[model samples]
Target chain A: MSTIDVNGTAVEVDEEGYLVDLGSWTPEIGTALAKGDDCELTDNHWEVINFLREYYEEYQIAPAVRVLTKAIGKKLGKDKGNSKYLYELFPYGPAKQACKYAGLPKPTGCV
Target chain B: MSDVKKFLYVNRKQPYGTIYALESLEVVLIGAAFEQDVSLAFVDDGVYQLTKGQDPSGIGMKNFSPTYTALGDYDINKIYVEKESLEARGLTIDDLQHLTWEDEDEDWAEKDSIRVVSASEMAEIMDQQDIVLSF
Candidate 1:
């Protein structure tokens, strides 16, 4: 039962600060969520965020870390393909943290 | 609650009828990274999870039973099976895959992975665990 104000409008978020309503998500909401975690979103971070959002829209499920790493590698290049690189971009966990920012449900199963 | 507490995951369901057994195994595998004192207990129909010669291809399911053999590689070598449950189901040790893991402390000597315990012995194990998650 936590909420964060985005552009003077109160929006509901979950315990982990992920937006409760998927329809309520916006660029500002993403920025605010990242700021709450003391993370300033860089272009590289946004790249992953956008990728995850697109991936979810198509698959109806958030990609796990391994899947995300491979997809990123294919689209971005092998230089950014492995989990080690993704972990550096999202320190908490690429599959989890990035999905939260992307406004997707938490990935299930073994991540 | 202290981090890395003794955890006993009790499995009592069949493997594929529902996702419980697979999901529980997933959590156990995930929990291993924490290096906690983890023990897995199989009772009731859950004993079928370790049965050999499983071919789920007829059901269009990819057989994940082989993952049980790899559990030891993940340092999850402690598995307990309820003796009565298997006996009631007409299953014996010969019907189970003989899984073994190398003991790092024993200079990589291979050791049996599963231990058959009586109902009373399993109760003692459950009593000793700090956290018990049954599926």
Candidate 2:
């Protein structure tokens, strides 16, 4: 475990950079995490991150990438649902990277 | 002949009391990716896993009851709950969440995924599985 400073507030994070305490997440923390990877959080990115947070809130688990793709298609339209689109948003794997920003555990069944 | 094998996961433990329930759920989700014939059985204390309005926050455990609803999305639609188990615990089908899946071929028509069965019927179903894993 380590701590990441989000504007002077240190929050605990796991080795993989996932928030150790999910409740510690804020939009700032998310932005900081994205910044650490040299990636900017665009509205399109926030769309998926926010969706993951909401999905975790309702299902209590981060969805597998396949499930995420289908669900995104259902909610965000087919253009934004495919893995190609999701990969473009979170190139380091949609379920893993987006879930980390969303303060969720690595998706169940994610390799 | 189709190469798919019938797999039955037998869950008999209460959620959060042990790791078996969560482990079973994870395995089910992973195994579903293989496109095999998979089904789940809830008997004994396992019925509690499906009870609705579960809030494990006070217990410091993730409330995974909601995850059961995702099983339908994984194409694991055949969920068997033993009737005797529910009666012994003072729970009826109404106490559980209504889980369903959409049939794509049927124009996304929603269909129920849970089936309450007698203990004897559960045994008959178990007998038909190519693989039966108990937890």
Tell me chain A's TM-score in each of the predictions. Answer: 0.93, 0.96
After superposing candidate 1, which stretches have Cα over 4 Å from the reference? A1-111, B1-3
Candidate 2 wrongly placed segments (more than 4 Å)? none
Give me the overall lDDT of model 1.
Answer: 0.82
Worst 10 residues of 2 chain A by lDDT: A102-111
Model 2 lDDT, residue B5, Cα: 98
For model 1, residues B1-135, the per-residue Cα lDDT tens digits are 457788899999988889998889777766665677888899999999999988888888757687677566556778999999999999998899888887758866899989999999999999999989989
Docking class of 1: incorrect
Model 2, DockQ value?
0.70
TM-score of 1: 0.56
Candidate 2 structure quality by residue, lDDT tens digits, B6-104: 999999999998999999998998888788999999999999989999888998987888889988778889999999999999999999999999887
Could you give candidate 1's per-residue lDDT for residues A1-111 as a string of tens digits?
Answer: 999877788889988777899876798888888887889899999999999888766534565565577568868988898888889888999988988887877764434
What lDDT score goes with residue A26 in model 2? 91
**Using Cα atoms with residue i matched to residue i, what is each candidate's TM-score against the true structure?**
0.56, 0.92
The residue pairs that clash in candidate 2, if any, are: none
Query: What lDDT is reached at residue B86 by model 2?
Result: 100
